[model samples]
Target: MLEDDPFHAELVGSWLRAAGHTCTVTESGEAFIRQLGRESFDLLILDWVIPDIAGDEVLARVRTMLSDMPPVMFVTSRDSEVEIAMILRAGGDDYMVKPARKLELLARVEALGRRRSAGENDIIEAEPYRIDTAARTLFMHGEPVVLTNTEFELARYLFRNVGRMLSRGHLLESIWGRSANVNTRTVDTYLSRLRKKLSLGPETGWRLSAIYQHGYRLEHMGIRSREGAAAAE
Candidate 1:
């Protein structure tokens, strides 16, 4: 948790601990980022207003820096509807304007768990595809489809974030790690492989579309990819 206020930090931390979860409190975004780099967390809760780095910046950095980032919740005093929309659009899973009610806060936290499960479930489903994280295997229509390790990882990440726009940098960082010498086109290449091997065309009830100027989005329905090879351009 990244909260500058002492009373609120202690209050929320104590509440989380009482609810049978471990809590680590950080007073600054720098400390928060340092801790995140050092340890894996189930959820990330932060305030919009921080002493040094703004909460939104922290979130952007997390997206670019962390490979397997967890769900994020904004617990702050910013109550404007626009701010709420901005946070959600920026990939925050939940938002609660502080001073937070104990019951409501805990309820929101648990609700995030339901939405994401924080990767707790070793097996994840995206319609016809079932990915077994423990075994690094993928099954399409209950039949095994062989994929390279990196391909399986990319497929799992794409399936996990279905309906969300993911930038190429986000994909590269998540799949290839930050220090890897992979080019951005490498992402498109791997995505093309997944498309052909898994039949990710419009016929499959899932469409992995490449958005112009943006990156990719694997949507279950309601959107279609543009025609032509320019889809990857």
Candidate 2:
């Protein structure tokens, strides 16, 4: 979700969680666009007004960015009939006027999500990591990396949710089944193996950072090096 207001961002994020949805919030349009360029989401929630870019402009850019456009909803302070119609005509799937009631917001979100496209290509590509979903094979820097099914799933999940803090319980239930007789230690052990096997280190431009009490997040740090170079110049 792209929201500038701190209170609204927090409230909407909590509501989305309550509806069993994972949301990543951005306070500025620049950050929002950067994230969309790298990460994929099932649905989007936008506010009409933003700091760096207008919400409507972001909606339009999202349409042009992806071959398969995901559902986008507008949650703004505007309540006018014309504004609502404009949002819809501008590629927004749903619109809710703020302050959005909990039940109503969730309902609108759920409705938009029901129409989400499930069709995905067999190949998944992120920089330096290429995943062939159909073959269950992964390549790092164009070289094949042997991975067990479980390990592959973990890697794919991490890439899919880059920068999002995933808890141990969530990882276990997601990668290993809930019924699997594995503790959080299993998660740590595998992550360590991946960190070594995938060369997830500072020099490699990526980090599988372990957060205390939280789990891990796959952070792309390539930008830091570029920023450092620019500063030196």
Candidate 3:
């Protein structure tokens, strides 16, 4: 964690350790970056109001340096919806207002861990489509289908637990990484994009669908590509 405040560092670090995670607390963004240069960490817990490099700037830098970057959570005092969205768009995994509850902090931390684990490294193969959780990449018929970061995130999440009905709110929180000030339509927009690119038609029986007011699901129909393509046209 990169937090200049001693009290905040101690509190969050302790919680993470209690959850069986190794926590390293740093006092400045510069120090955090320097430490990052020398080592690899599974996750970064950052303070937006830090000395030497703001949280958002630090996140961009980290992205450039780290391949397969680990998840990041912004622990800040700013609570506005706009602020939350800005941080998330800038590549933060999640955001929390200052003085968060221990339970809330732990839960967010755990969620990030789950997302990291569920990412590209955890590839799930259900025929023509294959998902790599750690790599956050999806392959259709052995060809990679390019996805934006958010799009890949949503796809991997659905692919990880195939056939499970995910609620919109749950998806919004998990895939976007924050609940404050986010438009639910954002989820629909991303899903629409995913459907257009990833859908294999009815032959493959692999489709992303909206369940009435619920969220979305990937249903396998046991159809292959050629047949599905013909059916689609």
The candidate that wins on TM-score is 2
lDDT of 2 by residue, 1-233 (tens): 99999999999899888766777999988799877765556688899888789998888887777655678889998899998998899888888888899999888887776665244556878768898887998898999999888889998878766766667777887788657899999999999998888888655567888878767778788877646745776
* Candidate 1 lDDT score relative to the true structure: 0.84
Per-residue error for 72 in candidate 3, Å, reads 0.6
**TM-score (C-alpha) between model 1 and the true structure:** 0.54
Compared with the true structure, all predictions reach lDDT values of 0.84, 0.81, 0.79
What's the C-alpha lDDT at position 124 in model 2? 76
Per TM-score, what order, best first? 2, 1, 3
Q: For candidate 1, lDDT tens digit of each residue in 98-203? A: 8899999999888887877554678888767888998999999999999998999899888776666687877887789767899999999999999999998655
Name the candidate, 2 or 3, with the larger lDDT value: 2
TM-score each candidate. Answer: 0.54, 0.54, 0.53
Task: Itemize residue pairs with steric clashes in candidate 2.
Answer: none
- Tens digit of per-residue lDDT, candidate 3, span 27-63: 8888898777654566888888887898888898988
